[model samples]
Target: MSGTELTVTLSGGSAADARAVVQALEPTFGAADERPGDDGATVHTATFEHEAADRPSDGASADAARLSAPVTVTVQGTPEAVEKASATLSRTFTTRDQGAASGDQEQERELLLEP
Candidate 1:
């Protein structure tokens, strides 16, 4: 874990869709902490630790992975981190801003993703 910690939460999609959403953010956030298996649950969450705005990737394609259906993603972290994650995800998916809540230490933004 690094200084800027971001938590990504997914809902309203299949397990594969959830994984794709998580993987899409990796190019900017780096590999997330031990990705927990989804127990066929409705909500899945992953935490990522980032050092800077964008992480260094190995030329991996983050755009090929596609979602089977619509997904709602909630990114929680510092304002900078949430903004970066949202922007990165929007580039990979058709995203619409749902809403966001912010505090002194952390902020959370929710976006709807369509396949």
Candidate 2:
């Protein structure tokens, strides 16, 4: 175990939907917290914790969900990788009027991104 932790909170997403998104990003040792049904938008939160990664210090995770506006994603990695991963995840995960419409798509998305 690397004894490392990464936490991220995102607004504008449904809890259920957000959960699905977090579930996609396989964290070494992390989980996603989603809060839905808030003024037509949803809120999603995700935490990444990996203690046994090859490079335990470089643990990273991404979470995203449907939103009234654009989806928000927060990623945390090692001090050095955090910034790069965060920027990439933020840009890649953030979306407007976009989301997975089917279970298969959602699953596929998760499989593609999760660690």
| lDDT of candidates 1 onward, in order | 0.81, 0.40
Tell me how candidate 1 scores on lDDT: 0.81
Candidate 1 Cα errors over 4 Å, as ranges? 36-38, 54-65
Q: How would you encode candidate 1's per-residue C-alpha lDDT over 1-115 as one tens digit per residue?
A: 3578999998987888888887887777878885637687888899998773546433335563588889999999998889888877877788999999989989999999998
Candidate 1 similarity to native, TM-score: 0.86
Predicted structure 2, TM vs. truth: 0.42
Candidate 2: lDDT over CA atoms? 0.40
- Per-residue lDDT, model 1, residue 78, is 90
Per-candidate TM vs. native? 0.86, 0.42
lDDT per residue as tens, model 2, 5-115: 545455443555455445434433444333233345444555565542434323333334233343455544455334333433444345332222233211111112221
Best of the candidates, TM-score: 1
Q: Model 1: which ten-residue window has the lowest total lDDT? A: 56-65
